[model samples]
Target: MSAIKVNQIRAKLRQLFEAHLDLSDIGPTDGERENKILSRCLAALAIYIQTGCTEKEAAESVWDGGDDNGIDAAYFDPSDLRVVLVQSKWINKGAGEPEAKDIGAFTKGVRDIIEQDNTGFRAGLHAKFSDIALRLSSPGTSVHLVLVSTGASVLAKHGTSVLTTLLKDLNGDDPEPIASSEAMGLAEVYSGLANDPLLSNVSVDATMLDWSYVATPFPAYFGVIDGLQLKTWWKTHGKALVASNIRHSLGSTEVNNEIKQTATSTPEKFWYFNNGITLVSNEALKAPVGAASRAAGVFSFRGASIVNGAQTVSSLAKVDDDNRLAEVRVPLRVILLKSAPAGFGDEVTRTNNLQNRVEPRDFVAQDPEQRRLRQEMAIEGVDYQFVRSEDSMATATSCELIEVTTALACAAGEPNLAVQLKTGIGRFFVDLSKPPYKAVFNAGVSGARAFNAVVVHREIERWIDKKKTSMTKKSGPAWGALVHGNRVLSAAVFAKYGSGNLSQAIASFGAAFDPAVIEAHCDIVHAKMAAGIEANYPGKFLAVLFKNPSMSKNVFDLACA
Candidate 1:
């Protein structure tokens, strides 16, 4: 009977993978019904489902199966630096469970990959060998093996024990287990397809209690709930809960670490210590919790997302392993946005997150002037990405967070200031609040001027890249010297275009960005940069150039040259 049930599941899985692989050219008859090629394609498709990667990217990440040594598809998620090893078992038969021997074979395959057994290393895997080896060597890196099976086999107790022992042995003397295994059964597959389609339909189901109706801010509810309940909710919804967040979890930061410490050790004080979570839902309903006054009850919210409190929610979820859920309760505020203003949710997320101890770049991104400019730029069909963090740069995002600040600083006649702030972003959080520095930012400067600054900065950097890439042996060291001179170049360009008036320069940016004119100014800018660097450091290390205010001041003075 169980075998019959598994066969039904296998058929459903076959349909799911086939549909997912349809976009790719991979066909069922690729291997003439041997199913090898189809199985490999299905493995990549399964990985896409788990990681939200596009079908093409997923296919490209697959390792050729001829010498795969058990793994079918592998992708290192750049967002979290997690290596996902996907094993596809496309069993046609109605097997009730995977054979114990088969389970051992999969574990051995993982062992071979970890040990880098050249005997089974295919050319495709070999190409990625260095990256995989480096990631394995890195501390705190996590490896997850997801077994995607058409067969309905739960790893039996003995199978789990064997696999655990094998994994433990492979990890050696590491203080913490670096490897974990998961089985993606039929239900998980179906849920992945149904709930998380490529174009998602946001829906949420939450258990809210001790809630009161608030009519002032549209129709709403104010409630208090245990932190454990929130974690339990996340187990089902996961990433979907915070779909509207500007960025995903950046993994543990100092603030998040403190959140976790408070959650686990001092859970009772969580409500007072934390600001709590904010959620926006399309629709909500109230149910009586006790001899209910209409004012107090449990509210059920749908199409909900945590606009604020992503860090709080993530920290609460982590405390579950230590069984600390019992001690924590947090305040909950839900806004009824069934007919809210346009862009309200984003505004809420941006407004709330800005108050936290975030990166300096993040503060720049939160500037209203920059936000308004970004919206205007989008209207003009230009992508001005203002705040992509380091890990988030896996995909191409033009106009990074630091670059925006650099452009602003240089445009405000402070090229050396831009250079000093470029690297070691954390080192200059204090500067974000201070003088001539703050003047370059959105709050202190007009959007048009800031936008013009970015344009000039990007153009200079683009020219720099073009020049460096075409450098010969004679110019290679020269290119290296000009590397930190980006700030100098930006200042020169701004000065050339802005004509000692940043706002006036912005008003006539079209003429400033002309390729021929920009090229003509490069020689003059380089000369200014060279003179400025020599005057500032003068036989000292490059670090001394930024350390001396006189150097940046000198570079600013050269903008008119």
Candidate 2:
């Protein structure tokens, strides 16, 4: 049975990634080497599953070539500052774990990366060495080693010990461990590939203390519930609990991490700190599980969907200590929609999420200057959306506040603004009354100016995408830097070629800017930036360099020159 499942997973993997696999560089191969190729493909699949990167990205992550280290594939997740290293074994019989020697080799490869040594790695790995090294060296950056195999079981005792010892040594006295490992066998691989279907109707049982009901508008219940119950729902149904949410749980974000830490360490204060979970359900009934009391009573919900507090529930689910979870209390509200007006559920979901976290850009929508710009852009037959809405999807004729801010940042000819964008766009929107925000969107800025900058910025992005596709193996380093320094390059192009008289230029150039001119400027800017980095910041990570204001300014200056 296990062999059948393994074969099925193998077939599915090939179907999904066969077009993405490139073995041209791997020397001549025969039937005997089929397992090796499959193993490499499995490594790519592991990357795709673990990192949520695209198939092409996963396939490109493979470094299994000549002079290859034991590491088969790797990905650097910028969101949480973590690196995922994968080693895969394809066993046709579906019976054996990775040998102890394999674990040793994998650990050594990890150590080599930790030591910043890429002397004996493959060309592809060496191409990415600097950026990976920089990411690994960053504080709070963690390493996750994944062992994927088409076997029925995980690593043997000896193999597990070898990997564990390596993680322990690397983690040492750090309060937050720097290294972790997971082994995915045949069953795990199959489940991941299958993309386990979400439960359609989630029924939850809760003990609501100090519960009260509203008889008017609609049937509603509000009370405090144990965090353990919420955790159980998350454990049983996962994303199914929040199927109706406006957004899924954003994994491992700083805010979510804080929530997790608080729940695990200081559960008693969770009720006061959290906004709590809201559920909209088809039906809710007080269960006669035991003698009813106002202090606590069991309630059952049918077709329940979490409309808000997805992050809170997910964080609670991560709490490993049940005792801590038992002490955690959360305010929960369940609204029954049987007699509610049509679309009220959606309105409930939307409004509930809106009041949770207000982004900096949200404040920009209230600015009179932004309103003026929107009206001005409307006169020119373009839609300028100052307000943020979950339902507003991007259209060719429309530009959102975020995109306009980015374009304005580039057009300002300030490398620091571009660096701020690269680091985090929230920095620009932090204070509308401040230098950065006011500097970009004040009275001097006209709708034509903003629109023109956006046009040019988008053109530059398209050119970069095309150039990346056309790059050859020999130009891999240049390609890497170009991608990493895209914002800085855009700033440089605008600084060098953007019109000084914005309103006049728009009147003359109109919406139809010359693609040839834009592409030419992009070519010059990319070449200059690449050359500058190579000459001045040798062995430096392009990502780190682009985020540094001083380095970015110097590179931008060189590019414009």
Instruction: State how far residue 168 of model 1 sits from its true place (Å).
Output: 1.7
Q: Which ten residues in a row have the lowest lDDT in candidate 2?
A: 473-482
Kindly list the per-residue Cα lDDT of model 1 for residues 4-118, writing each as its tens digit.
6455544544454544333234454565443554455557756777666666667766664566666677787653446778777655553444566767767766665554343
Off by over 4 Å in 2: 1-86, 90-145, 149-181, 184-209, 213-221, 226-248, 252-308, 315-330, 334-364, 377-400, 420-439, 503-505, 508-521, 536-554, 557-561
Worst 10 residues of 1 by lDDT: 472-481
Residue 283 in model 1: shift from native, Å? Answer: 0.9
> Candidate 1 at residue 362, lDDT?
58
lDDT of 2 by residue, 1-561 (tens): 888887887787877675687787655656646676788789988887766567788888887766666888888865335798988889888778888898788888887676556765876667677577667755446789999998845678899999988877776544446689999888778877877323337788889888888889788999999888889998887766777886666555446667788888888888888888899988877767654567887888998899988888887887889888889889999999878998988899998878657666788877999999988888877788878887564455678888999899888877888877755576576678987899899999998888888888888889987987786632323764556677888888887775574554444546456878889989998888888888898756454566677878888898899
Q: Give lDDT: candidate 1, residue 347.
A: 81
